[model samples]
Target: MTETKTIQKTFWQKYSTLMISLVVLVIYGWALTGLTFSGIQESAGEVSSSIFHGLTHPDWAYVYDGSGEDLVSLILQTLAIAFLGTVISAVLSVPFAFWAARGKNEGKLHPRSTTGKFMLVLIRTFPEIVLAIMFIKAVGPGSFAGVLAVSIHSIGMLGKLFSEALENMDHGADEAIYAAGGTATDVLTLATIPTIMPEFLSYTLYRFEIAVRSASILGMVGAGGIGTPLLFAIQTRSWDRVGIILLGIIIMVTAIDWLSGMLRKKLV
Candidate 1:
């Protein structure tokens, strides 16, 4: 009986916090439900049926349009934004990563490391939309704003990932290089970079994939891409054009995902 009581006490001790959290979440969810309308709008069924009809009958012309401002061209613009953003961000992240990484000259305890982390946090605090808006105001709307926003946001992510990769590297090579009187640059090129290259490439490719999606969405804010046209179609109730644009987006994203997946698998 004593042992049974001890087990019961231990179970309650282990689960008490979790139970309390669940109770809080349940109460919050119940409160939210009260704010929802109890009935659907009368036009809901009509709107749904119209959307279904539009999706079923997408505009084939838009799908294959090559007239400079067509779906294909817009998609290509989005691709460019994603590609350039990833490249710029990857290049910019190198110094930040080296600074923030533990056990380097600017390791975690160093002032430079703290500064690097602070910069990364500041960059990451704002969403891409906010960054895009700022860039739009600074440079005017177009793919330029989208590219800058993606690059800035990606720097924060790539910096953190790159730093972790560097920190996790085998330090024995670095130690050996240092013992052999190799300079910092020599050690980095011969020991550090070689060890972390695969991870770095992997992270870059992953960021590129994310940038593609972000580029598409950035167009909604007039940053220039298929998203702008898609939004226009929705606003104009041009269901056929929306369907075509959606298809193009789906195809583009899928192709990138497949390509990136294969490359990542090879790296791993």
Candidate 2:
């Protein structure tokens, strides 16, 4: 009888969190019931079949026809866009990162850090596609617009990452420099930068991987890359061309990821 009583007493302790989880699941199920899915498109079958057939039999000749619009040229352009955008964002993110990062003496709930986080949240929440469209209007729809969109969109994430790195970084080097009567610039260059540059470069390379994919998508909006021609091929029902473009993108992205992973391992 005493064992039974003890089990009863411990029941809530063992299952209270589980009961809360069940309640959340029920709430999610209720919310999902309100969603109404539309019927599939009538042409979806034919389109899917064509896409698959195209994939199996890609236009090999499109790989290089000496046309400036070939896959090789556009892939290079995409890489260039991602590289430039990532570099620009990395440089511009420094001030924002410093501003957002909490100082060593600051409390967890400091107003400055709170405001900076909120601002970064706003920036991160804005859609890159919308930014691309807005920039397209200003820049007349080209690779430059793509670059601008990526640069601005990337700052939100990069700043957050950089600030987090700063906040968690070891203070030993900084303290040592100060103890040695180092000037502010001396501390910054000799202690801070050397200590943090590797982290910054690692994050930048990861962001570059994401930027490459984004650059390709931006090309769909006439931002200038392989995606522009890929879209055209799709619209014209040129599945073979689509196949070749997809193949090129796959190869290019894979190569970049491999190279970046190697570089990051060294830098970090």
Model 2: residue 136 alpha-carbon error in angstroms: 0.6
lDDT of 2: 0.90
Model 2, 83-196: lDDT tens per residue?
999999999989988888898899988989888877778888876678888899998988899899889989999999999998988888888988999888988899888888
State the weakest 10-residue window (summed lDDT) of model 1: 100-109
Q: What is the C-alpha RMSD of each candidate to the true structure, in Å?
A: 3.0, 3.1
Clashing pairs in 1: none
Residue pairs with backbone atoms closer than 3 Å in model 2 (clashes) = none
Alpha-carbon lDDT, every model = 0.90, 0.90
Candidate 1 lDDT score relative to the true structure: 0.90
At residue 75, candidate 1 shows an lDDT of 90
